[model samples]
Target: MINISEIANEKIKEMLAAEETPNLFLRIGVKEGGCSGFSYGMGFDDEQHEDDKVIEYSGLKVVVDSDSLKYLNGLEIDFKESAMGGGFTINNPNASATCGCGSSFRTATEAGNPAADPC
Candidate 1:
């Protein structure tokens, strides 16, 4: 399971509303790539697969596929606005190592590639 901070909830609602889709769900997952071996993937989705897990936070709907659930469990998502810009940050307790870019990460037991460099 994951937790969305109030700031993230507000920003996500605004983005979803702009999409103009009445039933859009925020889909988050991990895919192979990046320096850390795994990268985060997030976007608006309209359909949920059979193995997807759905959670309702505030008024936003979130969907995470089973394969990514283990990696994302206990994650806390927050939105922050700084002089530079506004962005979403993920605090993933499950990640043993994360890349400098922040979006890429790896757990001790599940590194994505045999040849991927250590984080």
Candidate 2:
């Protein structure tokens, strides 16, 4: 399970209001290609695959695939707004190392293995 802040809830609500249709959920996953080994991905989703792990939060649904969930079991999704504007941020306790951009990260045992990357 992951933690969601009230700020995050507000951001998601804004996104939900902007959509033309309802039933859109946020999909969080990890992929590759950074100085570190893995990168986090987030998108508005309207579909759920067979292997997805679905969790509901504040009338919103968060979905994660089985493989991606393994690496993000207890992560938190945060909404941050600063001089850089606003965006969804990730707080991953399992990460031992992260790149300067804060997009890619690596665990203690993995180095440069880029999550879900074909390369």
Candidate 3:
């Protein structure tokens, strides 16, 4: 299961409210090609696929594709604010190793496709 922290939830709600597009929901997924072999993808999407797995948190809809569900199970999302700026943070339990930027990771059994360029 995926978990969204209270702070992240509030931040996501605010962002969603600011969007001009209607019916936008959060979409999270894993993609190949990163410094660590796999990268994470997260954004607002209006489209849904047949193989999507949907979960709701306090009225906010979160969707994950079947292919990425295995890599994102037990994932934790949070938001942190600093003097410079604020951003969302991800904690993935399924990742065996993560890159320095924390946006890329590799699982114990899978290495995906790593990019030659650094993140």
Candidate 4:
């Protein structure tokens, strides 16, 4: 299961409300190639695939593809405020190691494909 913290939920809702496009839902996924071999993808999407798993949180809809479900299971999302600014943060239980930027990770059983570029 995926968890979205209260702060993150509120921030997401605000962003959704500000969007010009309608019927947008949050989409989260894992993709190959990063400093740690795997990278995360999150954005607003209006399209839904046959293999998508939809999860609802306080009237918010989130979609996850079948291929990324395994890597994102038990994932936790949160947002924090700072003097500079605030951004969403991820706490992934499936990740054995994460890159310095915290945008890439590697699981205990899988290393995925690391990119040549630096994080």
Residue pairs with backbone overlap in model 2? 37-114
Tens digits of per-residue lDDT for model 3, 1-119: 99999989999999999999999999999998788878999999999999999999988899999999999999999999999899999999998888888898888776444443344
lDDT of 1 by residue, 6-110 (tens): 999999889988986778989999998888878999899999899999999987999999999988989999998999998999999988888887988888876
Regarding lDDT, does 2 or 4 come out ahead?
4
21-116: candidate 2 lDDT, tens digit per residue: 778888888875566777888889898899999988887788888888877978987888889798877888888887767787888668544462
> Residue 116 of candidate 4: its Cα lDDT?
28
Poorest 10 consecutive residues of model 3 by lDDT?
Answer: 110-119
Best by TM-score: 4
Q: For each candidate in the order shown, give its overall lDDT on alpha carbons.
A: 0.88, 0.80, 0.91, 0.91
Candidate 1 overall lDDT versus native: 0.88
Ranking by TM-score: 4, 3, 1, 2
What's the lDDT for residue 69 in model 2?
81
Task: Give residue 106's error in model 3 in angstroms.
Answer: 0.2
Clashing pairs for model 4 are none
**Candidates 2 and 3 compared by lDDT, better number:** 3
User: How much is 34 displaced in model 3, in angstroms?
Assistant: 0.6
